[model samples]
Target chain A: MGKRVGLEVTVAVAEAVALCRIDMAGVYPITPQSHIAEHLSNLVADGKLDAEFVTVESEHSAMSAVIGAAAAGARVYTATSSQGLMLMHELLPIASAMRLPITMAIANRAVSGPLNILNDHSDIMPQRDAGWIAVFAENGQEAVDLSIAAFKIAEHKDVMLPVSVNIDGFQLTHMVEPVIMPSQEEVDAFLPPFVPHATLHPSRPVTMGAFSMSDYFTEIMKAKDEAIKNSKKVILEVWDDWGRQFGRNYKPVETYLAEDADILMLTMGSMGETAKIAIDELRGKGVKAGLIKLRLWRPFPFAELAAVLKNAAQLIVTDRAVSFGGPGGPVFSEIKSALFAQANRPAIYNYIIGLGGRDVAVSDFVGMFETVRADKAKAKADTYEFWGVRE
Target chain B: MNIVENFDLFAPRLINKKELFSCGHRACSGCAEVLSVRLMCKALGDNTVVASATGCMEIVSSMFPTTAWRIPWIHVAFENAAAVASGVEAGLKALRKKGKIDDRYIKVVGMAGDGGTMDIGIQALSGAMERGHDMIYVCFDNEAYMNTGIQRSSGTPMGASTTTAPAGKASSGQKTWKKNMPEIMVAHEIPYVATVCPSYPLDFIRKFEKARSIEGPSYIHCFSVCPTGWRSPSETAVSMGRLAVETGVFPLFEVENGHYRMSADMPKKLKPLRSYFKPQGRFRHLTDAEIDAIQERVTAEFNKLTQKAKFL
Candidate 1:
């Protein structure tokens, strides 16, 4: 059994990465994500982690360096947030297309224009089509577990794709909580050493990142799409193995008092925990309110979501980022598309909450439920509103 | 200083005979850039990994399902080959230290064109050199962006007409002086920095071999001639490189540990710059006054370099 200690989520994540015994980490610091990079560099400097810590100049070079390290058959890791993640956007798809198993942590924050460094999903929303297996964490414990599992999942023989473990920027990354710090022996037993499918080596030469023309571009993209879609099986298997080993089990979509409830509120990231409090308060008041927390964002658990929201009459979907001039929020658009073909779909309402780290408290969750209930009669499935807007 | 003294016309036969960069690449018929790459690969031998930037060489050598590279190669993006080489070198070092991989001495090499090196890639290159990675970065300087149809780059010489900076009634083409990349690299205080042209194959091979022997970062700026982009005849590719050197437009020199050394037997007096410019259509639009001004600047720059070699 691992020791349970109170540590900041970012520190816990760095500790977990050290336990995984990565060969290299190319990191550049940004707001809210600097702690993870600092802790990792400190671990390398103290001789606690036997890895190369490359202090890259920018997030672009950070991503590029890791891609090269991974291509050289080294187990590599990196972390960034907000503008830094935006800077890394160019190389994200390249890493996926090349099928390099590079693990990264995204401290989700609001991107600039107003120049805010706060918790939001604005950072990761743009990267949805980058073809990475993205997972969200609700707390410190999940952050550590997901950071460690990300390496195993990415390095899996069948699923040779990069993975991003997203933790809400300052909300979860700075929050201190009791987390089980797994021992090196246990982590080693759980995750095996990486064996790359192809590497840049002189003995066996392979040309990677070749330019493709019209004749082969479509076929290559199709293969990449199939690879990410098929990786869900391995993700499930790894989660099951983790559950069997550790006492804590994880799910794609977790429910709280959800069974037999007619109205359910859906949330992702740390806000899901806050919504649970609202659910409990509503249940005490003799209301049938439940909570659905989405953990897996990519290779999205479509069937699992459909099964959970099957019998619900009303669903309040809250998103942290807005999609301008498009249909509501990015998540809201995807959720609507996921349930568009269903026979008995609920009246779904999307509320864009928490712009630039505005606090979404328990009362905010209750207020959303009330608004959905009052508008249930005339509500269309596609309607969305920004919650707590000044005007 | 005496690195190339023992080399002759037959000296290349004594070097590695293996051709790591295979044939059937789609470079133009008289492309000196590909020839420079081929000579570099031969000099480095088989124990090397090449990180290429997206440019003419990368596109021509690596088309999907058909690769001309017989050694390990990667082309990540346009501006990050040095950064990628740093990662490859660091990864190899860590793996060797941890006993995860063999401890063989495999050299990491980065290759990029002028646009990839002088313009978009300068930051990554400076970072890698400042970090002191044990790698070699070779800038195949074709002067302009030949792969994208002769766009103007920072390395484009003054009065050289490119597609983007065309000589016209209003403009004189490529008004700014060529960026001094080798000097910029020397400012980083890296151990080895050299300028090589394939017009002198033995000298080029010797510098590469010497760079391989160095235990730290080395920068080799290769002067490549682009006949198509320069509007010169195909057969003048090799002669063009010779003219570039003999006219002192692109001198062959080395900066080792802050000491500058010119290649042996440089001309006592450089040939006229017009002799170098007359064969190329890109510079045919240059007025006599423009050519005179360019000649004065080139002479002054060559003298300044020779003075550095003499004193430093």
Candidate 2:
């Protein structure tokens, strides 16, 4: 650790990327994610980070450029959010299909119909199948740590897939928090120079993104699926190494006072801290309420999540994005699907909460817990309710 | 003997250099696009990487487990070839500066069809050029979306029959004239921009060679004849490309730092537009009035180019 300084989460993200010594960055400006681009350009301009900063006209080009840079054996970084991520949707699978380890930071925001540029997971939920290793950050420190760790995990020899760190828009990205930024020397030691598995070079020629017909398309997709599934092992090891080096431990499923709790609340992103506070208040009232936050979104962490929630009697899963006409929120649906066949599983209730930056206070969490505890029959397994929605 | 010797003087040199692009790929029998690509690759030599767009060239050249390309090549998507090439150049630059790779100059080239370059891909191409990336962008102008069965594209010339813009009693085939992509590249104020036709193989090679030496963005718009899309005989593909330039339909020129110069000498007596359009089945429906209209437009465009070249 170098020093604990108050820094905006986006700046910390840029600093983390700078420490990693990226060779190229192609970024487009989008709301709630512009600071990352701005700070990165500044870094490149100031001669602090020796990287080519290409101001791409749009998110599509940004992703395309990053993919190109990665294919050329460059350590590349980019950042975007919400509509920007949606704009990059077409190239997302291509990046993974080509197996370019290009890391991107997504300041997660609500997708627009009414155009809400605020915190939500709606943006990344659609990209869950885009073949990228998606991770979530709870706050500024995790944003910094994961921003750095994403490069390591993505460039790992076993993995070589794109990694996206989702920092919740506005709530986390705009907020200033004390973060222990690792030194450049420490980062250099942690992240070895990126050795590309295969690169575009005249000396050693290779064809990437080749067309696949029906005869071999299924096999190619199956191979990609296996690659992502197997990436979990590398993610875990990288997180473990980070914990040992930095003294701040991280896990796929993090529990807060859930040792013997009868009721458990599940959350993702910055809402976890708020849920923890609610858990503390419920504990003061002699209620056995605990919190569980999912750090790894993609490759779902099924076994670890199942082990953690096995003992709970009830689990309140909060989602910031709606599935709209589906049974519940995206995360809720995944959790239900994961626990569907289990012999002894908790009664899981999903509350779509804090959507589009609606303030989710401690009182809202308490009310949600009270409602879940009061309802004995547990409603239905696949049903969800909108918490704190007016009328 | 004198006529044979003169013809031999203009023939493309069969150098001992290996073909970076090889046979056994799946292009159409008389594809001028592939011919142009083959010649372009030959000019670029071994020290080059290609970022190709999704089109006929990409689909035909890079089937999984087989590739026509002997050099490093990638097909990212339809509209991002220029953007991708920008990334490749930047990545190579970083590697070379860091002493991670030998400091030999390697060329980055972006290849896309007319639809990819003029339609959905315009933004990426413009951005890459504006950023002054050390790369070459080659747009094979077949003038329609031939990969998707000849849909009308912005590059489609006026009065041309296509699936999307077919000729009828009430309407001419394509309402708009072919978009001038070389002028658009020149507007970007890049270091070099040129127009070439595969029929002139030596001229094509020379333009690409000059483009490769340029330090900044260079654009090459090649007027490729799509015999299948244009409903012409397969054997007429090369003749069609030659007819396009000789009839003043598509001028072969280069713009170096905004200085426009014609690559080939202008025809002393321009061929009539009818001779160029008569053989193409897509233009068979054209009436004499329509032919006259096309002739007027071609002559006017050619004159405008001649004036620009003279001023430069």
RMSD of each: 1.7, 1.5
- Clashing pairs for model 1 are none
Error in Å for residue A26 of model 1: 0.3
lDDT of 1 by residue, A219-250 (tens): 99999999999999898888888889997788
Identify the runs in model 2 with alpha carbons over 4 angstroms from their true place: A380-382, B1-16
Per-model lDDT: 0.92, 0.91
The 10-residue segment with the lowest total lDDT in model 1 chain A? A374-383
- For model 2 chain A, where is the 10-residue window of minimal lDDT? A375-384
lDDT of 2 by residue, A1-391 (tens): 5899999999999999999999999999999999999999999999999998989899999999999999989999999999999999999999999899989999999999889998889999999999999999999999999989999999999999999999999999999999999999899888899999889998899999999899999998999999999999999999999998988878889999887988899999999998889889999999999999999999899999998888898989999899989989999999999998997899989999988989999999999889888877767544489997789
Candidate 2 clash total? 0
TM-score of each: 0.98, 0.98
Tens-digit lDDT track of model 2 for B188-304:
999999999988777788899999999999999999999999999999998899899889998889999889898654465689999999889888888899889989999999999
Against the true structure, whose DockQ is highest? 2
